[model samples]
Target: MDYKYLLLVLSLSVILILSTAQHENIPYEDVPDICAKCVCLTAHDTDKRYHHLLSCTSKKFQHILARWPEEFGKKHDNVDIVATFSGNNIELLQQLPATNATLTFSCRHCGIKYLQAPTFMDVPFIRRLDLSWNEIASDELTPDVFRGPYRVTHYESIALVDLDLSHNQLHALDRKIFEHTANLTKLNLSYNEFRVLNAPTISALSSATELQELDLSHTAIKSLSAAIFKSLVNLRILNLSGNDLTSVPDKLQLIGRSLVSLNLAQNPIARFTEESFIGLKSLQRLNISYMPVLKTIGKSVFTRLETLKRLDCSHNPKLVEFDLESLTHSSNLTNFDISYCALTTISLFVNVTQESHTDIATLAKPWPHLHTFQSIGNPWYCDCDLIQTMEYIGTEGDTKINQARCDTPYFLAGALVSNLSSQYICNLKIPKQYKAILEEPPRFLRKRYIILTVIVAAVVISVGVMLGFAIAAIRRRLKRDDFGVEPIRYTSVRSSNLSAFSQGNTNSIIVNGNGVANASA
Candidate 1:
């Protein structure tokens, strides 16, 4: 029985060894050797779709591979492949490698000056391409450089959704350069050398009807064409900051229906006219801060912005005049930031005069939904009108008043508005109608008055008591003198009589009853 059991065990062991060898002989996909110096990762995107990323950034490579290895896309079915070749010294962007899988290509900061035609012909499924931070000029981009292969004898465009060509030497583009990218949605051309965006140059982008976001900041653009953005009906977000625009671009109503956010900060805009943003009814957030020459925001500048929620006009050193009534038209305004400006005071009533009574009914309620009001870093004049306006706003809404320091009236300078009483802020300037709001004298002042009154009363009482005592003493002295005067007279008469008796003249002599005065007569 032991010999039989050993034979059975040996047979099972041989079967296991043969099975392992057979499994090892089966074909399995491995990482391609062309990406030996690159880091490969299989990660998931925001939609939970798995994709392969090959990063070859800062590898000191002077050239890119002309073609990818065969069977690369056959191994991974329905998976995207993204290849990056950024921060290399490759001066020329030649034909790209072919791949059957959906591909995304990026080659930023490669010092590339030339782009050969038909660059992406072999990469039929290319979706996104990034060529930012290169030296490609306008003349280097041929018309057919972005075109893909034709499908079913008719031109079928590639599936490119995003293209970034920012930070290049491109001054202009051919009107037909982007004809093949009908599905493009986002394009970044910021930090380029566009001094002026002429109508023809802007017309080149009219074909991208689906484009939503465009960045044109810091391009030294002086002005825009009147109808430059009229064709981009689907455009939503636009960044025009850090430019030389002296005023709002004309004819913005062309894209006003679809625009949601606009950034006009760091410009040289002097003021906003009543019709500056007339047709932008869908706008939500606006940033017009950091303008060195901005001065005024007129009364009707924001009259039509009923849907605006946030407004940032901070950091303007010359912005001294802002009509508080201008905000009354925007009923849905929530966050307002006017910090670091030159605003002295903000009042809801129009044409407000100092030292005058304000009717409660006349005061309008602006910013009914206001929550945060940032008024710090400004020279606020904490007068009665300003205090009253703030109190009204605080009571009507849930907005928190910022702790702005006073800069006028000399006495309240550097004092926080929240810590100051309305009476103290207004002092004698408070109107007669609102005198009931004035509080009693300060605690220290009341204490000082009590002390002074007590001292005065004690001095008066002490003086009265001393005067009474002096009068009584004078009366007693008078009585004593009256009683002693008759005796003195009697003595004088007796002495005189005695003298007369001695001189034999005793007619006027008088004596006391009990003690007889013996006369010599």
Candidate 2:
């Protein structure tokens, strides 16, 4: 009896193992009835339920006649359906099949050109629709393209919270295009051909009062209407990069109450006036990088940005002057990037006086809360003021400074600002009266002095040798006069005396007192 009981237990254990294995390796069922080329499966959701996922991607289908299996909702307990029909050749989106479950549809890169009216009439519960990377034009995007049929009294509105229409050929949208998507929270219109977002197009988006994020990048936008974004009161993030804007969009104060992150990069803006970013009281992150023609950030340009934290002005090749005092109002700045610009000094940050050419005893610290300061890739002129500023930054708090290498004062060129001392930087600038206390000159100056000393010594040695040779020649001439053969002397001898001299009479020849020749005689 005991052996039989053990055998039964072992058999049951083997059966349980086989069942678990079969469950784990169950093949995803194909839903040919809905989309001949699609696969439908139930995925475990975070809410402890299974949601239907209908994937029809990369199927070279021209159209889909979705007819969900009769028992689909019963099997999945009426859970949501996330459908993807991307990478297809569907030119017109007429309508989606009726379904009992909420839907999230994506048809990216579908070559879709037209969206027919009542496109979502049968599936009015769509929460997200992505039709990006299509050939849809402005004229085809009629106001009722996203509309559904009426329920009983009023028209049924879509539950759409996110809509992506990027990478299309749309230049202008109908004035009431978003009338059915009033619940939209995020809208992406990037990579379009909108050279100018006209007033009517801006008014069309007023119905989406709940929108928080909008992407309009790479749209070739040259300017914006004064009230373009005025109705988007809840907008938090706005991207206007890769445009042709010459200045900041006007009347940003209309959305100043809720705007947070703003990106204006890759534009041709030349300068920022004091009122450039005015009324942006709630802004935190601002990116103005990659502007080819930007040159100056004028004083108080960032005046009203008291809540600003991170600011990126990097990669502006012509950006030379930035009024650091303009950042005084933004004391909460934590990350500041000014890299790859044309800045030549850090005196603007340290508030150094050019007239005095002296370091301040108590420097004005602009960004007290700054933690990440990237200032590299600039033409930094390392001087007394720069050294002091860098020293103060290095010792104050835990701020991280990516110091720029020097580009001026030939001696300190290519040297990191953090590695230099005030003595080395001020060696050439110290007053002559205080030279006694100054450290040795920089290596380049010392090298110059050594070369100058060698040249002077060589010159002096040459002059001394020439003078010695001249003096010796003079002395030898005197000695030759003293001991060499004396000139023939004749002391006024008469003709008779001359005859006697000729006859070798020694007494007739008379010499001068100094024994010098008398040519007159």
Candidate 3:
């Protein structure tokens, strides 16, 4: 009876364990439709949903569509897909099988030589697309390269928001390339061979009216048409650095309403006039560094930028004067860099932080918002005037001023201004007496020297007379001893004392009581 009960209990435990295992395997059965779903990896989200990610990067995929899996898209209609085909050997990208899904596709570094309308026929929605580092040419591509047969309107044809086509050999671009893609917000076409951006190019780019961030750097672009960027009214960050621009492009005024950051570094701009930045009232950050030929900048060029925060004007060795007064209107300035500009004095730069320099009532403290001043690599004159400025630096705790080195006044060369001594400053200035003498004539100097000599001689004669009287008084006191000196004043000695004076000498003196003196021979 005991063995029978034990067997029954063991069977019941085995059945319970099998039931739990069956329930755990039910989720996989519900997930179907795996057609052409070549997911490289799958990740679980916080809500326990699986995200399918596919990448053919560096796989040397040739004609990816030809190798499409047979079981792709079996049951599922909508899915999340992230696809990458970078660093592949795919030359031509033709029509892809249609799918209604959110997608992010990257084809950078793919040796694609041709792209047709059906290239993305299967892909209707693309949030981000990267086609950089390819061999696509401007003339070979049509404006409707991404247009699908079913997409009738501009919004239905192009759903791409971010596109990158950098590092290509494109010399000119067609306006129709972006005509169907009016919703693009960010575009990067940097590192191309575009020599000039004329009216046609500007008109072509105007189709994307909602563009916010654009990068055109290192493109060898020489000039831009006036008001070329007028259509991109929503642009905020524009990068034109590393170009051949000779001046601030006049077309920038079109986007001045919303531009926040402008990079103009690595150009050959010779001067900055007031009209150069006339319409950049909303600009906050400006980079004009590394300009080899930049020498002159107008005093009021930055007056319009009332909300300016950071200004980088470094690495321009020919720049001499940067009028701080012109920036009085820029009350929101925080970070300023003027390093390596060959400045002769820190007076102009340092004094701008004081209350006397600006009329802004909000600036109660010295550079209240300024955190860093990269003013190093400049030839600072460390005279008495600069010493006062250094003291202010040591006392102020908020401002981080560094690399404040001296380049002139041989004694203070290579020395930091914060460590200078008071004695050294005093030694550098001329003495008051010498300075006064230098101002006087030679005839006045001679008269002054004669008067000084006469005063010194009179003082010496007075001292000599007082010394003679003191010596005579001392000698008279010695003569008035207790001995009788009436008989002879020669030596206070009597006749009996004559032997003590003579002894064995033949010539001797003798004195009697009658006060007469005789010599014995």
Candidate 4:
């Protein structure tokens, strides 16, 4: 009788153990507002939920959905428990409350390109998305793949905002596929194997009219045409870093009202010509950093960026110089970096944080609001050439330098010239390095000798020449005056005794005739 009672007690205990295995359904009232119909066992009040399960945040859930999951009505009444996708488990997506999806993921071993099919709509709550890392690559797209927002079966309005398809092995994307995501705000297509993008692809994005931020970094886009970004008029932030862009065409007329930030860092854009930044009037920050081969800055290359605030060009080793004079007039520039370029000194007619010329004593007018300036790895010649600029910079504030040495002029290298001497500038370290240009003690003896020699030589030569010429002229004039008169010669002689002869002719004709004959003879 005791054995029978023991057997009945063991059966009752087994029945109670089976009853414990059943799940106690928590009422809907106990769930957070975000998880009323959702099966999240742990959702805080801060959890977000949309009429269409907008996103699952704050809680980790393993979702499980059948390939042919039943849909009850406009609101999905049936969604399974979230589960992990493992090898032994049947391949399945969790759930979708929408009718379409743009599949983008990468799973190399499984040979899955992307699972962007309407079959995912049978899962629950997903409309648009980013499948960045799962291996998924498909070339041909059936018409069923492009049936997300176009189908009016689900809602009066679609709930698609952003899509990211980076890190996938996608080689071909039909440009027409973007029309289905008209409501998307941001699209990330970076880190893929796209050598060339057809023009119609960007144009289709323009037709979308809502894409704000587009990241096309790490593409092999070799060059840029005029209308490459023509369709993206409303794009506010564009990231084109890590590409092969050598230059930007002039036809890139990006309007000011829409664009604010442009990041083109790490491209092989060796040239920053005047027309490089043509029509971007309202740009605030421009990052062209880490470009390995960018060698130089063109004159007025950044002229059109009137509203620019920050310009970063820090890591281009071949960039040897800059034009500081042209940018001295710019009032909007505040933060400027040109570190690691082969800079020798800070002269005028380039983009700079200050009017960075050397050897000037004081500022005619200081840049009262300029913030930072970077000039390192340059050949700094600390002669009379850089005294004034060095002094002015030291007076204004400390200019930070790193691993830079002045390389020239037989002396004064690695010796800090920023504050060595105002009057004299010599070997910047030895004997306190004082040897001035204009305001040192004069060598009176040597200067006097030189001055006297020049003055005496000039006066003596000039006086000697003048005196020689004057003496010669005076001698010639005196000789002409003294011997100017000429002597004249004349002939003399005669007598007339005709009257006396005539009067005595009567008395003494014979004697008068004889006397007249003698006189005549």
Candidate 5:
């Protein structure tokens, strides 16, 4: 009886364990009190439709269930497109609501650590998903991380368009990580710890052939292979800024025909040769700014980007030489920023009536779309050589003249190039040696010259008066000697008198033939 009773007790325990496990898996009917404040949205565009939104942003919600609240899709079946969950502390994402309604979903800054496979498998209409600023990595991930849920009644692949995984510690990825999503377009993986994009990872994303924009900025990638982006022929925008790339890869020619925008700023690229961007004909906006190590850009570097409209080369203190003529090939170039380069001069895209002179109005015709040109923070020489450039910028009125300052000849230092007087430039046209004399010197120098002249004249006049007195005394002595009786010299008396007269106290003097003077005080 004891044995039979023990078996019954063990059987009951097993039944109880199964029951508790089953209960946890079932979806909850009532909304959690914490999530009750989420705003259920209504369609604003149509006014008749119900479009729902569930925002639990920054709510510090710790866990999510394996299934959404029961009947959430059925009750609000008319709703479409739920979007945005910013600044939350959600740690785990196990599942998503089973509906073709959600179009956009963002869980940025959520501190998410674990995300179960098939998280978005049931939601077939997710267009945009942002999981940025999380602690997501590939170590805890499986090959089927994006696989859809099993035993699904509805069957369709998720129509995910945009995905942002930026600011995460995702250093590696599985080969089949993105295999399920074929229609992904814009993918941003910036601010991550990707050391290199290997062949397996590149192959995984190659299925997304319709990709338009891809941003890998601030990722520490050191090198690239040609086959990495060969499949993305239709890619339009590519941002690889803030990396350790030494040179641009030749593989860029693969998407050269369709690519539009490229950003490689904040990198340590040493030079930009003719082959740097050779085949990118359709490229428009190019940003190569903040590259401290960049020093040289070849003359024909930009000759191929015929559709380029904007180019930013700012904050490169070592880059001194630039060939603006290379940009003339890209007729659509409109916006240009070459600020903080410590440049002394630059050539524009106009014919010279005077040598090196640019006529902004005449040049504006060929490049009708060219409008903004920024050259600020450069050490400009504002002498006669730059007068034409200054005059053109001032007259065009449409051109933007950033705070380009003078840095030469002491007098022009710290003064703005635009504010320089035209009269000063005209005077500078004369030879520099002659121009100094023609132009009035600074007031301090003039005062110094005047004081020195007065001191020299006073010294010369005093010497002249002393010489005149000495000559008159010598002539009187000679006349006395000629008219004397018996040639009496009176040498001793004259010597005493002359010695006393030499002193300024002498009141009277008598001179005899013996070169002496007698004085009475």
Candidate 6:
């Protein structure tokens, strides 16, 4: 009976163990909280709007999302998940369902205050946030609200990779804002009022080991110091165009030497020296266009770029000439835009590259392997010298010199600006040298004195004609008996002429009809 009772107790213990295991292993399919933030629900609720953003299969935008702190909502009672309400709509932001909101963004019209301290939602694993065009001040981000920068999100765990805070009213850099974003790569603070980038700002960005691209375009940057970009080792592109930089900063060679594209357009660059791009060995595209004050380009400006391809220095007013003889070895350049510069003729770019997008040769002559040439707005003198260039383009049929319209020389201003076609506004004058020869004949000058001497001898004959005319007039007056009217004016002029003759030809006198000397005559 004892053995039988023990076996019944063992069976009861096995039954209890099996029941506990079943309860513990029950699936979470019935829980409403687990189903709340599922991908399917989030995707469906957002009307499939954020399908690409919510996608985790790829790491394309991983660098931009790592700016926000990891453990968000650690300090506040009401947690927030959705990042959309931070600035755009305060009423809607207050109504946010609030928990695990990873990303947030708003346009320029958002009225969010810049001084709002960091909330619990900012501490979580949230990665990306775009407050572009919002007039947010520089003091809003605090580490206490987000539990510091090193925190992480347990779900979909990954560091943020991208951040775009462009077009904001940020007047200055508060380095603490970026101190927490240690893992970010691409950062865009473009179109801001950032007048200066101090040492703290550089240090904060250098913490992000994966930074690759940084854009500070359209800012109030007066200068770019070497200390600002020293930490970003893997940087590929740095855009600082549309700023007030008068000179290209020194020691930019520290940007990993692998930088590809750099835009320095619309700056106050007066000259473009070859040393301006000394360190960038792997650079490809460079845009320094639209600088009106830029006057000269160093002959060796692009001598070092072996892999450099496209170069655009167009829309510069004072740039008169571009001689590409020194850059003949860099033949890989494909697209070149030197349009609207001070190029008077098409000879400026004879053979700069092997393959180009503009056909500059068509404007003057069929260039050797020339492509798209945007030579316009120069004082293109339409004359016979351009006919050779036109002939080459007409035969090759690939040169697009038709767009290189002449802008100066009043007659050809609006005309179809082809060098070969238009007859240069018809100058009808003879050659100046030939006209001078005709005016100053050697033989005529030699006989000039003789002709004057003969004219003086002919004056003796004129005296005889004047004497006869006077005698006839006197005879007419006697016939008509009209001597009362005095021919004072005629007599005075005749007397004056005779007086001059008497002064030179002395011993000569004028006699009246009765051989009486008329002293007045």
Candidates 4 and 5: which is better by lDDT?
5
Against the hidden reference, what TM-scores do the models get?
Answer: 0.68, 0.70, 0.66, 0.56, 0.72, 0.56
User: Could you tally the backbone clashes for each prediction?
Assistant: 0, 0, 7, 44, 3, 32
TM-score: the better of candidates 1 and 5: 5
State the local distance difference test value for candidate 3: 0.70
- All candidates' lDDT scores? 0.77, 0.78, 0.70, 0.54, 0.72, 0.56
- For model 4, the stretches where C-alpha displacement exceeds 4 angstroms are 1-112, 119-128, 138-157, 349-370, 382-410, 415-521
Which candidate gets the maximum lDDT versus the true structure? 2
- Candidate 3 per-residue lDDT over residues 78-121, each given as its tens digit: 55567777887877755454555667888888877777553564
Per-residue error (Å), model 2, residue 54: 3.0
Q: Tell me how candidate 5 scores on lDDT.
A: 0.72
Model 6: runs farther than 4 Å from truth? 1-104, 115-127, 143-158, 346-372, 382-402, 407-521
lDDT per residue, candidate 2, 1-521, as tens digits?
98987887777668547744643343333444653456877666677665877888977767654456553565434478888889988887756767756788899999998775557766777888999999999998886667665543356678888999999999988888888887889999999998988877888766578899999899998888766676789999999999999989877788998999999999999999988998888999999999999999988788889999999999999999887766768888989888999987655455444543344435556677788888889988777777766665543466666767887766567897777766556556633222122367676578778899889999999999999999999999989788677779665535555667677766646667997433333
Model 3, stretches more than 4 Å misplaced? 1-39, 44-50, 65-79, 149-155, 346-363, 384-398, 420-521
TM-score leader:
5
TM-score-superior candidate, 3 or 6: 3
lDDT of 4 at 401: 40
In the order shown, the candidates' Cα RMSDs to the true structure are 22.8, 20.0, 23.4, 25.6, 14.1, 20.6
1-521 in candidate 4: lDDT tens per residue? Answer: 98987887777668445533321221111223434333224222333321222223223233322221222223323322232222212122322333332222211122234343432323223334555554545353322343433232231233346666677665556655655455667878788777776665555545657778878788787765545456667878888888888876455565456777888888877778777877787787788888888877778877677777777777777776565544544556666676666655565422222333333444443344446656555566665435445444333543344334555544555665444553465323433234434444556547777798899999999999999999999999989787677668653322234544665643332335445432333
**Lowest-lDDT window of 10 residues in candidate 3?**
26-35
